[model samples]
Target: MTILSYADSALSLLPPVVAIMMAIVTRRVLLSLGMGILLGAVLINDFSVIASGQYLGEQVAGLFWDDGAVNAWNMYLLGFLVLLGMITSLITVSGAASAFADWARNYIKCKRDAKLLTMFLGCVIFIDDYFNSLVVGSVARPLTDRYYVSRSKLAYILDSTAAPICVISPVSSWGAYIIALIGGILTAHGFTDSGHLSVFIQMIPMNFYAIFALLLLLCVIFWDLNVGPMRQHELNAQKGNLYDEAKGLPPGANSDLPEAKNGKILGLFLPIIVLVLATFYFMVSSGGDVLAADGKPFSILGAFEHTDVASSLFFGALVGFIATLALVLIQGLDKLYLTKGLVAGARSMLPAIYILLFAWTIAGVIGQLETGKYMASLASGNIPFALLPAVLFVLAGLTAFSTGTSWGTFGIMLPIAADMAMGTHTNMMLPMLAAVLAGAVFGDHCSPISDTTILSSTGANCHHIDHVITQLPYALIVAGISLGGYIVLGFTESLMAGLATCSILFVISILVLKFKSTQAIS
Candidate 1:
């Protein structure tokens, strides 16, 4: 179909939005997303059964077999999910989580401290957002609950830190994606002569939203500023009715769930440490000349480039599996029970897998419709030079919110933003691209239907809707600060200034809220 025709038709259909709406209303995520994908395919092909079938076939093929899509599915989502499930299973089987909770109980002292610690741990696991969400939430939830820190707050901490931290960390999965896109943009814009290091460094300073958001989260933790919907939810949680009893246990109890014996914490910790070390080794080994082998320099990036995300995760999983087996054998636990733990771990990942598949399918349909290029075209003619960064940020945020996938949002926005930057003379390229990343994370951070949001809620044992409602106010506060930061960045030509401005605003906002709260109490 022609570009205009496709744009007009797809805009009218609004497949992604419609699909998500259906999922929310029906509370059947897979079914709603599936119908949405089918609708997009039919709409794209003019409702031709044969064409729709062909499109669907292509989507499946691309999702499972194509270089980019398949690699993303395997390396990032699938591997992360599998490892998360396995780790959780081992922790449960070993009673390590319960032990950790008990241990933490002595030190935490109060609900506020418990919440702060959860946020701290979330920041610590910056290797991957997906990993961060699952690990921190699972580990901290029970401890937080024992102190009466609401599950919704725990989920908020997880959701807030996951993408925000990942996007900025150079060694993270998010770092890899951003670097790859930046590399492409560099090549496209005649900046290849400056080299990748220079390009990455330039972008770092201009990543206003990312730097400021992290600062804002810290302020939120330290100042304990709760507002809007989150305040109401916290009040509800204080009343002991924050979640439905039918869903599961009280905020964090492992009651009625299997618990592992002593030393199971080692079973969980050892494997994860090994995985982190291995990931670093591999990332360095592949990067070209970052390491030495046999009196010669080696390329870690080169090796990492060839290795898929799934393979990297599999390496971690192997370590975890072996650790679990050894712990079981040494502890004299039944081998059958260990096997059962593995199965249980894999089973828990099923929900994440289904979500990944449907997300990929939706991304494919949108890509087929060439939505990115259409979006670029729309922005090309209208955006004022001064407003480019803010506009790009908002656009990226909207796309991620609509699709409920920050990675997918990144995939679409990076290329388009790159093109826009190139078209605009490369003067504001770094800030523009950084804005895209910042916006994607911002949207995903607050999106109720987002996968990270779901995983965080699951890990925290929080009601999903409760988590969404409670988290929204905090996310909006950060977003508002970020918007102002973007504006400063666009006008002042000093990214550092913009970041500093936003950070001050965030701290002031939190303090004002705290003072107001204290006054009300008096």
Candidate 2:
């Protein structure tokens, strides 16, 4: 049974706002989320503590073993995390990591080459954000470290490319989820003969945030566009200090792994290559007839449309773990050493698992309070249709930023944007839809409490808050540009004109960064 709803009042915003503030202040996502959950419980009991303690107990316990948001899929994700930890630990101990670093030294001669290769690898792994963020960061960090690239910058590249690429790629898990969401909405609203694939494809042109974000990453890479806290991090990195003095080496750094004396690069490459290929295969196969509404055979796009990301990724990781172990055994390493590496790898992912639980708990509490519904109703009052796209963009961004979940933001905003535009007899359907997508991603990019942010930090071995601070400036630049684009599209109703604004602003920003860097150097 759904509880904690407050009939679209200001109170629905309290839990998330408190959570966001507490996260930034304490820099402890778990504690902040717990406080938010307690606050939600109190609010549900009409701001009384008579039974709030008991209710909070149930809610917290429910996060682990409940049949709600933190159910089977959550377990699959947890399993994937542990499995991934094992793989990384294996690579570290198996000597593959050092070997790859040596191999990368020849090809990646300078900072630019290292950063660009990181970017290239990130873009290439568009299957899923979790996969992309983890794989790219792990593979590139050792290479990047040699050139004095900051962990914060590496995290930014990982985070930026992960969600943005997945959001835009039609064959990706993100796209599949979006397509399914859009498909359901389309069916409910009486639209026929049009598949979500075509709609997603058409929506691409107006996905200004995702497009410009990738472009912004290029500017940062090619032009060394360091701004805000990122610049200090970069400078400190050049001096061989990758983190702020206050935050020392993380407790679970991979330094615990016993380095092999004769590790081969292929030991690392073979397992990752297997995971990537197997994930794609399982994704297509897992969807089966779920992609077809009428019991028909699954087409290529149809398979992607119905793919189960958690299942496929878990399968890929399991296979990858086994492959990595086998490779280690064949390398003539002590069996005990291999066993230790696997256990250590799995153990290393515990922090991420705890964070994921808290994230899901808050998401659950937000759902119970109907927070997204309350947020959406803010746009329900009479408004000018011409400015709807811009309004929706800001509102959608706020929702995603508060919730720290882009998919949740999409579910709430997309339907409202669609119905609102159709009801008002406006021609902004495509733009409004695109705005929902753009704002969700932009907000997710900026949100410190976001899963992708946590995963990015985990991947790059950077302090979580460091990653959040360093990346925020870049996310805001794209957001500001996206908001302007939406406003222009609102007025002109021309996608080309609006998109042109994004391109122009990005180029100008790159030029400004270049000038800034040149001046600083001299």
TM-score of candidate 1 to 2 decimals: 0.83
Per-residue lDDT of model 1, residues 1-522, tens digit only: 222246534463377778767765665666877888888888778888887888788787776678644556445556666666766676677766667677777888777788778888888877666667776776776677676666777777888788877777665667766777778767876775766545666777566666666666666666666666666656767787555566554322233446655644565566566656665554454443323433444444333333345555566556655665676668776566666667777776666566667767886676666654455455566677667888888878776776677877777787777787777747777888888888888778766557777777766767665676677777777788888888887787578878787877877777777887677557
> lDDT tens string, model 2, 238-345?
999876656654312465578787899999899999989988888898787575555878776778877788888899999988898889889988777787887778
lDDT of 1 at 111: 77
lDDT, candidate 2, equals 0.84
Which ten-residue region of model 2 has the weakest summed lDDT? 247-256
Off by over 4 Å in 2: 68-70, 289-294
Per-residue lDDT value at 102 in model 1: 77
Q: Could you tell me the C-alpha RMSD of candidate 1 in Å?
A: 4.3
Question: Which ten contiguous residues of candidate 1 have the minimum total lDDT?
Answer: 248-257
Go through the candidates in order and give the clash count of each. 18, 1
Instruction: State which candidate has the highest lDDT.
Output: 2
